[model samples]
Target: MSVPVNGGDLVVSRLSSAAPSAPTAIALHGITGNGWAWLPVAAGLFGRMSLWAPDLRGRAASRLVGPPYGLGTHADDVIALMDHLELERAVLIGHSMGAWVGSLVAARHPDRVSSLVLVDGGLGTAMPSWVDPDLFMYAVLGPAIQRLGMTFPSPADYLAYWAFHPGLGPTLAGPTGHLVRHYLTRDLVQERGGWRSSCVLDAVRADGSALLDDEEVLTSPQASIGHGIPVSLLWAPRGALNQPMGLYGGAWPPWRPLPEGITAERVPDANHYTVIFDPPAVRQVVSRLLAAAAR
Candidate 1:
């Protein structure tokens, strides 16, 4: 289900087994991901909290929504979703780009965010100004950027493309196969001759540009924490390709560390994408939210 937002309906997946007043958690997915990406976390927390995962504008079901897309717009959209739900305050859980969005929300709408859980994202290191944004994105995101421009004859073709995806495909062979397939295909829209990914390239570019220089949102939380809002970060040990090293390397331009007062933890044996679905990773996320709710 989805609710009306600034530009269009934000598709939301609701998972609830508790009372309506149970501590509510609003989830935000990574840059290329949609609401359904948080299904595992919601499932893990079933019967405990009412979860709402929304597809931010220009991704998945919200692809048609026009731009003005960036971290600020995304933060506003999240607040709008909270308004639609009539929620005064809720825990905000974000993964990757979603984590960045969560930080902005916590900074701008502190009253509406009770706590923050950032999974492998909110603190993505910024690139130097001399580095070309497109080139940097290409180097970091690699084929993920290229796939957004390609087209496929059918959902099967798209699935085939991902058949060898280093982190996602091999993991799809188990009980979670069906769920994985749904996650991959959910954002696809059939076009005139074929199907293309629902993620908007222009929006993605705009977001990447914003992320390159947006330090305030990621760091401002240190000040915001003084207001009694708690923030936690759970990062994977590897990159998107499941590399041994994490995204932020120890190079000259090292990834900026989490600001003071923000708790941080690492998910061992997990990469950028796999962390959300990893069993231990999911447990950590579930435990954090439940503990926050208990307080």
Candidate 2:
């Protein structure tokens, strides 16, 4: 459902198994993705936790607002949503860009977040200075943009396009294909003749520079909050972005070293995307977070 916050509508989807008393886990998806991306993991964990996944502004179903789509703005949006829902404190789980925003929220608004599960991100690493934001956007968001550009002749065609994503290929081949198609088609708009993606590409491009700046800010020591809250960092072992041979050269950022209080876990035999979507992998990370929170 859409809730008005900061002059913009936040699109939030809640998944619960039986009752309202279930522990709530707030999830955040990466760039070019939305709340739907978390459904698989949410379903697995919903038996024990009520999951609330929201599409951030400028993406998916969320309403696009003013400029400065940096970490601070995204974190504030989350806090506003938490207040609207009257959630005193909830576990915050974020992936990729969402992880960065989650870190900012944990650091700035400590009381609102009880614990953090950073899936395949939030190692506090900085991108190199030479990389241009536009180029980075194309590389990172290319697959999603390509899916958006297609004019599917039929529902099957659209499903075919989605099933081919390298990240989802193996998982989408059988029964899981049905699940993936359901979520993808749920967001498609039927125009005069064909299907169109609901995501706003222009709005996503508008804040390209801001995303880069936010990454830099996150890597800075100033963004660090001293050791009190527990943080769980889940890193992808085979992701293109974090691969040893890639641009960053597998080096962790100097400014944002693993804090003394945070626990880090590396997901073996998975890329950035699968680390979150794969059921077993996701459960492993969630188990770690729950265990850490218990301590």
* Per-model CA lDDT versus the true structure: 0.78, 0.66
Clashes by residue pair, model 2:
none
Error of 1 at 66 (Å): 1.9
Question: What's the C-alpha lDDT at position 270 in model 1?
Answer: 74
Cα displacement (angstroms), candidate 2, residue 71, comes to: 3.3
Residue 167 error for model 2, in Å?
2.1
- TM-scores for all predictions: 0.92, 0.83
Candidate with the greatest lDDT versus the true structure: 1
lDDT of 1 by residue, 1-295 (tens): 7777767777777855568767999999887878888777777888889999888889888897767788888888888888888999999988888888888888888888889888877775556888777787777766677789899999998988877777666656755566667778987988899998899887887777877877876464664676678888777777777666666542323265657777777676777777877667778878887886766
Model 1: per-residue Cα lDDT at residue 97: 82
Over 4 Å off, model 1 = 248-256
Error of 1 at 50 (Å): 1.0
lDDT of 2 by residue, 133-217 (tens): 7678768655665665667777777777766666656666643445455556655666778877666665566445545655544
Worst 10 residues of 2 by lDDT: 245-254
